[model samples]
Target chain A: MTDDIQSRLDSIAPLIVDGSPHAVALGLSLKALTPGRAVMGARYDESLIGDPDTGTLHGGVVTALLDHACGMAAFAGFGAKDTPATLDLRIDYLRPAKPGLDVTAEASCLKSHGLVAFVRATAHDGDPDDPVAIAQAAFMITKASKLAQERARRAYTEGRME
Target chain B: MSQVLIETLMSAPYVARFGVRLERKGNELTGVLPFADHLVGNPLIPALHGGAVGAFLEIVASASLLASQPLQRLPKPIDVAIDYLRPARAQDVYARAVVARSGRRVANVRVEAWQNRIDAPVATLHGHFLITPGQDDTAAD
Candidate 1:
């Protein structure tokens, strides 16, 4: 059963990221996905630098990367059907990301019950042991999100979205 | 001096890309995030991306810190907690930050982002940032 869900997530992961305009703007790509885990990547771009003097990527980049990865994990945890909205997110910046190095986020859904899912994630430039940031988030399947999901499904079926 | 600071803050590569602008009067600063197609996260609901809203909050927090005092460089975020109170609609968003406390090393900030109504904020953020106080020109030498 889990394997089936994993495959389903794998098939839709690329489309999910592609459909998000901000994700596309930042050039995010899904690296891996499973039942309750997700790995995503954001390549280094000079245009995203925060401090010109240090050439370090902005903390916001890490924030967005972790949020998306955590959201993906929550989505998979909810059986990859329900569209969950983020309730809250907390992020800690462990260190600055080096210039010209891509950043990757690995997230796992710790628990899911009722309409809420909890997720934790870490962002690293290269070495997993040395993380750039850590994030914890809660996602809830709201009425609005469910309606939005239905609308998206209809759009997809109608060939409005590619 | 304040105008120059606001200009410097908006000129950052990422902030410029988002078209974030700061309006400063005296020591107060307010952030404006204009609507753009690329800022959409969920096209179905047509809501602004949560990540974009979060980033904007952080930018406003840092801007408040810069406006409150003389800083050697932009403040570095230590950690941030953000709560999504409501879905940000696809339109212009505004934000204001309050520096709760500032010392030699760290500053605590709280920010609120609202769309049409100021009473109803779409999101709120609380964060801590590392800061470096600027030295006087004579002291620098």
Candidate 2:
């Protein structure tokens, strides 16, 4: 049963990136995944620059990345089959990310008590020690597998969107 | 002054991607995130992505900070915290920001976004921004 559940999660986990419109548009990719962890990445794109003067990537992009990473972590924490809804996310921008390198976020599920799950994540360009931003978040885990499959079907089959 | 700030913010490519419109009446301002197919996160729930919602609220907070002061350049984000109250439906979303405090170097702001009714908010964001003082505050006014 454990092996079966793990295999199912492995099959469905890719949907987090492939099924998301905003994530795809942002060029987010899932680089790493585990039972209770996920690492997502987005390379620097000139189109995402908010400050035309400085060419700095917009803070909103960072927020979106962190939020998605945390949610992924929570989802994985609940056996990777349960969907996690973000309850709260806090981010601290330690510094402006360099415009040239790819940015990646690594998130871990700190704990899941009852219906709520706690998560922490950090965004870095290359070096984990020098992180661009750090995030702490919480998510609500419920019937994720059914909801995720339904959304995927809606986007792929119905073509309305996912 | 707010008009100038709105124009500056709306011109940014990132903010323009969401087609966010700014409506201001004095200090109180509202940000509008229109409905679009690209904004959906979960098609099963037919809801807006949490990242989209978070980005929208953050943009509102940044815009509010820009409009509240007379800074020559856009303020940089220091940190932000967001609380999701409910699943955001795939529809037009609106947000309002309040400048809690504005110091010489930093400013704190709070933002709330709602759909369907203003009384209920789908998400809330509280954040701090780094401010650059203008050469002359009087001329900015």
Candidate 3:
């Protein structure tokens, strides 16, 4: 990838992450973004614990993180020009994340074609060797999403709203 | 008897954050996820986040297992495959889980989530969970 493309992706990555309300609710942050790849992090918080007794993070948290990470990878794989919708997602819980530890997901677009992309990602706390979960997902550029993107581009060009 | 168990299961910290609740009629359990601004993934389409919908399905699956039988602890998800049929609109979402098979050590569940009409499910989940049947006293419920 060229420097210009990398810089453009970097600038737009945070917009995608921050624009999502659920991502904000979960405190997800875009750590890095490159062609066909993205790294996202979620801060550890008490309210997100699934088991009060065990203090383990909920499996749903991992699901959401992986979903967002994989989506970002797919978006980048499309050169950050198109936003895709998830078709299906499969996740395997390898183990419980230790209490009081933040988690991160590293996702990469395995392949991309006309309108569909496949992505894989792994979630880990601090050690990449010990993954908490792994996810495989497929994303497609739907008609509704494409129209929405066009409208947003037009709005941006006209400076109607930031 | 099962209602009490369902309440306990829904009281989990993470599940409570999203304000998910289960309504019971006879032996059946229906899950409701009230719409919230924080649940939206695409403000452009203004649709509910796929993650929120997926997590809600998982919660309903576990709750169904708990309502079915007494368990030593909360069921742990082994693996889950979720198919998104439509973009979930920003509104209250409802779901019901059907236990396809419940073995001694593992349970297979299917979940359907919808917003307006039950026939039109926005997403579906097929998953397996690890469960431990209670010894005796726990089974009384």
Candidate 4:
């Protein structure tokens, strides 16, 4: 059941990128997925740099990726009918990422009940054992009817780009 | 090397007034927020506003970068997501930052904050900054 839902959500995942400028600017892309999991990939770019000496990526960018990844995972877990808003997120930073390395985030839905969902995710440069950061997020699901209307309105207002 | 960066950060009007200080031990940069009664956002709940903590984390991350690159101005915050682990008590706050990945264009940083208790963190920040090149400083702005 969840696997079927994940497949359907995967088809619409590209739609999530349509209206968010932050997603566009950060060069975030959705990669492959398993039944209850999703992976997001972002390359290191100049627009995301913090300091030249340390060559560290800023915390905000990581947060954005984590947030988006978690939200998408929740959407995938809940099927295509619901849109989720983040209620709260908690993160732990284990180590700083060395400069010029590709960063990847893998997120999973822990549980879903009624209109609430729980998710856990990790961000890392290469190794899962040595993750850069880990996060636990909670999301509140909206009604399917409302979400469909909102998506339609958003699509109409934003229109298609040439 | 970090002396000039520390001086510039401490000299900033907002930072100076807030009494933000930094000390480097090895590669780690630790930021200090001196205890001030006025810094407290709420007296009844006695909890610090999340925004205040966010701003402080931003400074720590920026200054840590400046310590290495003294010539560049502070990078603007593209966005910051903060997770409040616990209520910040009325005490000095300490933070440290690591540059996860620094490219020619953008930099990714992760920062953590704690009060007296090191075992428990008060908050964590994941930030993305848009790095401006040295030659195009004025033009980039």
Rank ordering of all candidates by TM-score, starting from the highest: 1, 3, 2, 4
Q: Is candidate 1 or candidate 4 better by lDDT?
A: 1
For B1-141, candidate 2 gives per-residue lDDT tens digits of 444555667877788887898887866778999998888877666778888898898888878877776776777889999998878987999999989998999998999999998888899999999987565344545
The candidates' DockQ values read 0.78, 0.66, 0.80, 0.06
Docking class of 4: incorrect
Give the runs in model 3 whose Cα sits over 4 Å from its true position. Answer: A1-4, A158-162, B1-5, B135-141
Highest DockQ model number = 3
Residue range B1-141, candidate 1, lDDT tens digits: 233444566787888998998887766789999999888888888888888999999999988887777777788999999999999999999999999999999999999999999999999999999998774323322
* Residue pairs that clash (backbone atoms under 3 angstroms), model 1: none
TM-scores of chain A in all candidate models: 0.95, 0.86, 0.93, 0.85
Indicate whether candidate 3 or candidate 4 has the larger TM-score.
3
Listed in order, each prediction's TM-score against the native is 0.95, 0.90, 0.95, 0.54
Cα distance off (Å), candidate 3, residue A17: 2.3
Could you tell me which residue pairs clash in candidate 3? none
iRMS for all predictions? 0.8, 2.0, 1.0, 12.0
Q: What is the lDDT of candidate 3?
A: 0.88
Model 2 RMSD in angstroms: 3.0
For candidate 3, report its TM-score: 0.95
Q: Rank the candidates by DockQ, best first.
A: 3, 1, 2, 4
Clash pairs detected, candidate 2: A83-A144
Error of 1 at B29 (Å): 1.2
DockQ of 1: 0.78
